[model samples]
Target: MKTKKILIVGTGETADLAYEYFTYDSEYEVCGFCVNRQYIKENQKCGLNITAIEDIEDKYDKEKYHLFVAIASSKLNYDRTKVYNELKNKGWKFASYISSKAFVWHNAQIGENCFILENNTIQPFTKVGNNVTMWSSNHLGHRSVIKDNCFITSHVVISGFCEIGENTFIGVNSTIADNIKIAKDNFIAMSAVVNKNTEENGLYTGNPAKKAGISAKEYFGVL
Candidate 1:
């Protein structure tokens, strides 16, 4: 078996959780951690040296280490996405982290840099695109399509064949009906039940989810 060295970016709760998960798996050897300069209060995390992103490739060779950005918030995820994209452009590879406890179907197609947390049930033929984050216990129904850079919170239920567009954030406990089309940059608030198609950049909420605002950018930062 080939051993892979990994560099986890960030030292927050989510990053620590990821470190624990990957280290116990044995296949991945966590080399160290890397965070933005502003977030690096100390020089180490979990007893391993924590370097800034600017100095990471120097110590761990961009081609030799797999980088995983473990920031949790939606806005931070967006910022991390930009930083990762810049790294990718410089020929550095990024890695995805799928929890061993997650139930992912064999036929599911998950794109690069995705993070699927514990208890996620990704059914057969589901297509999940790059930089997506699916929090714990979410049910991604069969044949569902989740596009790039989306943040799906815990307990969300996406029915079969539903399409979640780019840069959208699906809040906790939300349920999207089967075959529904959620357009780009939308925000579906917590506990909402989406029964119909949504327009691009819309903000939706409530039990059958109606359009609540123009776009999430009006409230949250721009995607």
Candidate 2:
């Protein structure tokens, strides 16, 4: 197989983790790092040159580089998704990272640009959509569906048959009850317990998680 050149589109902790994960195997050859102009602090990152995303092809061929947006957190994840989609439209291939330490079942489906961290347990028949981020040590129950651009923090327990919607964020140590449907753009705060169906764009929290606000956009800005 041909060696694939990859560009990690961040220089943060998550980007470093992704770099280490992708470069470990012979399949990928990491070319460099790319970030928005404002975030560029150093000329080089992790021993690779850091370039602005707009000048990616000026330094490297766009067709020859696979891009991975490595930003964590829901708001930033959504922002990164937008950037990835724009670059994808301009003909860049997106890369996903599935840690070697993660335990993913054979029947599970993971979409493009997803990052499944170490020790994650993705049970059978689970479906994770595009640009989703699953942090370390989360348990994704059997047949659960996590929709596009969702950010799942570490130690989350998503029960079987649960459906998490687009642009939502499941905070750390949260528990979603079996068969629950969390609607689009919702935010489930840390340590909350979700038992019932949530409305679109709702912000839920507490044990048996109740609607805390109308939507996350009020706090995080529009996705």
Candidate 3:
């Protein structure tokens, strides 16, 4: 079978990282980069000429090329999710990059456009939904469900049977206790330890994580 070609969508550092990882570590070949017209700063990125997203499908031919949106966890990952949804609705195929060093159990299910990086452990029966990003050295415990568009930062621990809601951002070194349900749009701050179920748009912080009076959107300036 011919190796699939991929276009990384972004001109930022994440796109460069994706290019390196996909080129040397995965089966997909990184052909070029794409971004919205207003954000184009340079003509090229990673030695490939950058293409405006407006003209991407015609130039790349989606039938023969897959896309990987390299946007990071901005606005609780709403920005990345929007890009993913727009491309998917337009009939674009996506490519996921699970690092060769990540430990994803055979029984685990991960959806499209996910970026699972090195040393992450996705245990048995764990379900990761579309457009998710699991950064380095995180532990997604058994039977846990991480919903769509969620971003799990480095060194995080999501204990067994927990449910992470959609568009949530779990910060670096945070720990979600077993059986916990983190609500949608939650922003768990760095090193927070959540032992109880969270509320929608919650802002959690501290060792024994406590929800702040303000919503996650307000804290992140999304509102």
Q: TM-score, each model?
A: 0.93, 0.91, 0.97
The Cα local distance difference test for each model comes to: 0.85, 0.86, 0.93
Cα lDDT tens digits for candidate 1, 1-223 = 3388888887888789878877885367888888878878998888999998888767877768888777765562467578668777878787787888999999999987788889999999999998899989999999999998889999999999999998889989999999999998889999999999999878899998989746677767764
Using lDDT, rank the candidates from best to worst.
3, 2, 1
How do the residues 69-175 of candidate 2 rate in per-residue lDDT, one tens digit apiece?
88777462577778778887888888778987899999999988888889999999999998899989999999999999999999999999999998898889999
Evaluate model 3: give its TM-score: 0.97
Best by TM-score: 3
Tens-place lDDT digits, model 3, residues 1-223: 2288999999887887888889889989888899999999989877888999999977878789999999999998988998999989999999999999999999999999999999999999999999999989999999999999999999999999999999999999999999999999999999999999999999999979998998999977885
- Window of ten residues with lowest summed lDDT in model 3: 1-10
Task: Report clash pairs, candidate 1.
Answer: none
List the candidate numbers ranked by TM-score, top first: 3, 1, 2
Q: Give candidate 1's whole-model lDDT.
A: 0.85
Alpha carbon lDDT of residue 12, candidate 1?
87
